[model samples]
Target: MLVIEHIPAAIADEILVGKERDTVVMTAEERRWGRRRLRSSAGRAVALALATGTTLAPGAIIAVEPTWYLQVEAAAEPVLAVRPRRCGWFRSGRCRARSSCASWRH
Candidate 1:
């Protein structure tokens, strides 16, 4: 098991030119976590004990070994799209509910 306590600053592409790459896929919600155990696509166990307020971003390199480095990848999540029945309501600058007009204030 690999315990990662600190995340390094972004590494330039040239710096990792010859290194093999492995990835750990995490969900959007999981990316916000500062501490958790995860598995790389190569099946390596990785534990993150990052500081508070530390959030993992896509492509973030979490570990660098002799021959390869582990990076983070965000998993695709389902999104809900809501469309109003009447598009004219917004085109005319008028909301269906007057009580909610404050929400549309710009």
Candidate 2:
């Protein structure tokens, strides 16, 4: 198992041009956790011990080995799409659609 304590800064595109890449798939909820164990596409175990409030974004590199790198990938999940008919009302906090507006207030 590989333990990663900190996430590296964004890697340059030129440095990753020829490297083999693998991804550690995570759900939206999983990405919010600062510490967890995940498995890469290649079945490698990765343990994260990140600092509080650290969130991993899609394509964020986790590890860079000699010839390969591991990154984070957000798994596709169903999401509710809500489009307000009046953008002005929604922005001003005076949306007339009480039912729809109340649902999101919590």
Candidate 3:
């Protein structure tokens, strides 16, 4: 699964391109300074690199791919208990976005 850790850059062209599919509602972790971390409902990582300055609402698309759309879902509880263990060398093993996961292209 991918751990998206930032708001993706917005492209006007991409907005014009249009989604060939429906909007997807994915899980989002509220990150530092209002940035967002998105994960697909199926658990794949979704990348958001745009500057959305701290107010990306739930049900909003972080970014759109040709095949899939990634959105946000606010978790009422702390996100750690819900996600799988982290994928890195940290002793805490908390859920996090590794460099590999952050490398997902828009």
Candidate 4:
């Protein structure tokens, strides 16, 4: 009942023409079954987050099938290198230190 296109010609020909494999219809059936599984998995994920937390922020993931809940987190990705702080008295206008100091002129 489902018509899928945009497949590479070789794969499409093989799947539809029954030229290379005997279980062509089986492939499509498997894909449909997988989608149902994903939905169930995603629901379970949401339930887990809710049961564990008093305050819950819900989020979901849509892979090939819209079935999976991923815990969405916001985090700052810090750069690995130590960057020189930008100020008037340091090389390249970068001063490294926590306290405010008088400007050095060389």
Candidate 5:
């Protein structure tokens, strides 16, 4: 069934008996950090598309593929200043520091 937030589950079940979920459950605190209000340009675009009854099938598939690209860039920044070694060599290998030597001191 199509799950929606803020809408009563009973009503949603009736409307989306065999549809899909639209929202996921998150803790109140996690919601603040993990979820954000859909206010960005992309958010507005999606909202507009939905309101206008435009199809997002192909576009949604395309968007989903690149969703992790942003996360990959954010995750890779810290390593840019350091060196990468074999997976198990971190604790045993010598690494050059970017600024402070504290990381290699011990």
Candidate 6:
């Protein structure tokens, strides 16, 4: 599916009224953060590519089509959401970025 750049919030949720929709349950680790082509629970290789280095929260809309919406929902597994960081992490001297899950926290 064509990954959407603008979210439903950017437009409006009412646009989806009476429209077909599907939910893509993704493991926290699958997205963690950044743009990663993640596979949905339906086995469709849906791309969750985001440009702002933002992690998709559960219930967040990922993509939209002419007649449907691709949503992002967290899995039963622990949240492995990653944090956003600048490219100059090595130069800024703050390398401590939130990685995946509570177990990943340092």
lDDT of 1: 0.83
Superposed model 5: Cα runs more than 4 Å off: 1-12, 31-35, 38-106
lDDT of 2 by residue, 3-105 (tens): 9898878788888888999899998889999898888999989899999999888879988877888998989999999865554457766766666565453
How far residue 7's Cα lies from its native spot in candidate 3, in Å, is 6.2
What are the clashing pairs of model 5?
none
lDDT head-to-head 2 vs 3, winner = 2
Q: What tens-digit string does per-residue lDDT give for candidate 5 at 40-99?
A: 222221112122222222112111111210000111122337553333334655334333
| The 10-residue segment with the lowest total lDDT in model 5 | 66-75
- lDDT, residue 43, model 1: 92
Error of 4 at 57 (Å): 11
Between prediction 3 and prediction 4, the one with superior lDDT is 3
The global Cα lDDT (0 to 1) of model 4 is: 0.27
The C-alpha stretches of model 1 lying farther than 4 A from their native spots are 83-106
Go through the candidates in order and give each one's C-alpha lDDT. Answer: 0.83, 0.83, 0.51, 0.27, 0.25, 0.63
The candidate maximizing TM-score is: 2
Task: Assess the local accuracy of residue 60 in candidate 1 as a C-alpha lDDT between 0 and 100.
Answer: 91
lDDT of 4 by residue, 16-60 (tens): 332221112112223333222221322331112122212222221
The alpha-carbon deviation from the true structure for residue 53 of candidate 1, after best TM-score superposition, in angstroms, is 1.9
Question: Model 2 — which ten-residue stretch has the worst lDDT?
Answer: 97-106
TM-score of each: 0.74, 0.75, 0.36, 0.16, 0.20, 0.55
Q: Rank the candidates by TM-score, best first.
A: 2, 1, 6, 3, 5, 4
lDDT of 6 by residue, 1-106 (tens): 5555545556477877776667877666665656656566656666555667566678877666778667777778755687645443445545455243223322
Ten-residue segment with the worst summed lDDT in candidate 6?
Answer: 97-106
Better of 4 and 5 by lDDT: 4
